[model samples]
Target: MTLSSNVIKQCALLSSLALFSLSSAMADDHTNKPVVEQLVDTLSTIAGPHPGIRKNHAKGIVVSGEFIPSPDAATVTNAVHFESPATPVTVRFSNTTGIPDIADNNPSSFPKGIAIRFHLQEDTYTDIVSISVSRFPVATPEDFLGLLNAVATSGPDAATPKPITQFLASHPAAKTFVETPKPAPVSFATQPFYGVNAFKFTNKDGEVRYGRYQIIPVNGQEYLTDEQRAAAGKDYLFEELPRRLQQSQVEFALGLQIADKDDALNDPTVVWPETRQIIKLGTISLDTVDDNGKQFAKQTMFNPLALTDGIEASDDPILLARPSAYAISFGRRISGQ
Candidate 1:
């Protein structure tokens, strides 16, 4: 019998909650180091050590743009990005893993990263960091570390069930992430990105709503077929994006998928149903790139938890862990480690 999407989400949520509780207890007993440090360590183990660079999604192209907010944007939040006029923006599109030159078409580089910096008034800024996947592979930082560790330990010569297989056998969400089909996009401009972690948005009246962000391509979604993927170059996305921009600006609509009363806010592994209301917050137009913008993208750290007002992060451990992890990366990069 085929199970419904809601049933699948509920089952995933319950499993994730149980795993999160158990992982927290184990973490409290086992390690004294901060979860962010552990997360970085595990990522390094999987991706190999790369000093002075981001632990993952190290290779990227930077661009400049403008965020044109919708009139109804203030209805969801009083955040400056929504209430203010069109703001300048900086964006980066990246591949997965610490290997900076990893092939874009490699299966390992499935979920591309999209990091945006909304330049608000008075030198203040808000950031949105998302990936191509709608839901995260694991719900908690502990499980995320475990997943990385599992992959690091697994190989053709590994004994018994193999580390990754054993790990996935117990974690249905992680298994789903591994099994999910991630086709290569024709270009970064054609891909849709999603913020897996839910955040609370508060309007001027102080009414709060939980939602996840989605960047829908204004050009519509398009993916390369297996044959086309095989024919693509290693750095196709990086090369194609700039070439495409030379012709015209690339655009995407910034949208927020508001959660229902029963939605699992803390479990990012549980994707909210499509039936949920989505509000178009703004349009992001990537027009051009200059030396300064490229340098800013290289130097600046985009932290999802870097909120202004009227917006707050959820209690998800993965969400909580991001800022510290990003700090570690930023420090290493700036200090020339």
Candidate 2:
């Protein structure tokens, strides 16, 4: 680390310690934002520059498009595949060339989703899919933010800075994933995880709480082999999924694992263990029938923070950073602001 960076870390540590000491003595206030919320707030304070340009519609929706859910992108556990003639899925495979939300339609742009938008006028939740099964394995929002920035500026010769930054922020588990981005293909995917980053859940009783979601693949284990995507090339996932789905129905089920008050800092990349078997809530049906057709090939957006409750958000660091960054670029696209 640079001398300046080391000094910055020290100052941050002291400030956090002082704040925690003061806060601990105070009465526990449910009114205060949860730890996860605070993390999100912190990420906003340290936001970056992501200027997105306009783009064509995807499938029929104005939202960003899909990134092919290939093996390297498959979730690790709690994965299930389903089939239905009524709903066919189409995914767009693109290169996340620059940061999370560069020009949405940039040929090299890799960000899969725009910021989660709430029409407020409507009540609807969309698809259940992911590139990497586990949301960010990282812990801190700052680290995730750096990763996003790195992704925004990445290219073929780009260093492993994004993933490496994330590992540093979260430590332990993230380090392993970053060091060895073990590719577990959807063809061989079993339990594909979702970042389930974070969202608010309003129970039937009208209580507001937080939680994360996961997409578990139901089909037998089918992960991508190392030979699959040695490159994060364009349409990398696109070229493979068709052959797999053509032979069999490609699907995975959505499951929910609510976060308790004490369990809010949930990051998807780490294993959540069999004991926490997510409650099966829904199924993702991927058929050859894609309504999006050419449109699907045009757009892509896959932010884990985009969620609806029964499903909700958590105080996880990366989740906190995602919405704001996602929104800024998404707004840039629709409004051209």
Candidate 3:
């Protein structure tokens, strides 16, 4: 049965209410639960459950692509994909939030997601998971949990200076993150995605450096005007993707924004100066859309920590916690939760 967007939204509201009740009953025992479980539970309570859908970024489309490394890539990292002629990639573009049927124009969906998994030889692979925002809202898993809980409790009817408002007041970085302008993109092909977390790059010669990734579209950034956004269809972004791909391949230049000597390497909430050097690493060319994109997205988990010999994750707490949190969600998705 085909469900209308309104119906889906209403259903999500009901599911969220039910999950909220369940969560409240378990609230007293929350501290004893692992951080991953708490995160998943809070997300489910906030966005509601759609069986077999992801706990976060539930709306996504998978596409096939390849990475063509630049000669400059070898100067910083000896990762297998960077040294190879070409590496096959499975890419997923998604909206923010766990609501599977959120409208393309919804404010909650502004920070779009892009996950790329590089398929190396002999069953080895690495993934780059990024978002439209250049800096993250929080720096640690515990603080992130608090932020999520605040969001869950702050509804339209909540008191003045709601939970989220109070939380934001105390957290300056999160306030900045919220105030960051996230314009609605005309199409996924036109938006740039940022890797908020830093990674350690080690060359074959053993030189080590830290940097964050910036994936910019070759077509350049384009965003909907206020009038255009208001007049656009709820599924405009999703509908535009396949049609655009059919006409021509979408490409993005991948670069690393190198950190300075005194830069904060482990804090994703910290933003480096724009004047910092960016080394072109490669190009991502997505040619075909997966017919079963939704199913593929459901089955696959694009982890940020899935690294190789030359690339290692920094000491960022949020980056370190992603794999476990994603694993819990992946298990539930595959099991038809």
- What is the C-alpha lDDT profile of model 1 across 36-152, one tens digit per residue? 666767776777777767778888888988999998789999998898788998889999887878999999987999999888776667889999999899998778878887888
Off by over 4 Å in 2: 1-123, 126-137, 147-174, 184-191, 196-211, 227-236, 244-248, 258-271, 289-311, 331-337
- Which stretches of candidate 3 lie above 4 Å from their native place? 1-30
Question: What range of 10 consecutive residues in model 1 has the weakest lDDT sum?
Answer: 1-10
Better model by TM-score, 2 or 3?
Answer: 3
Best by lDDT: 3
Clashes of each: 0, 55, 0
lDDT of 3: 0.86
Predictions in order: lDDT: 0.82, 0.40, 0.86
Tally clashing residue pairs in candidate 2.
55
> Taking the tens digit of each residue's C-alpha lDDT, what string does model 2 give over 1-337?
2234433433443344344323422112543543333332333332333333322112122222122233311122211221111222333332233233333223333223222122111332233434333445456554443443344445466666554454455566555555544343433224354544655555444565444556556775554455543433434344455666667665665555655555545565554444553445445555453444333222233334434433444555555444444333333443333
The estimated TM-scores of all candidates read: 0.90, 0.51, 0.91
The clash tally of candidate 1 reads: 0
- Give the higher-TM-score candidate: 1 or 2: 1
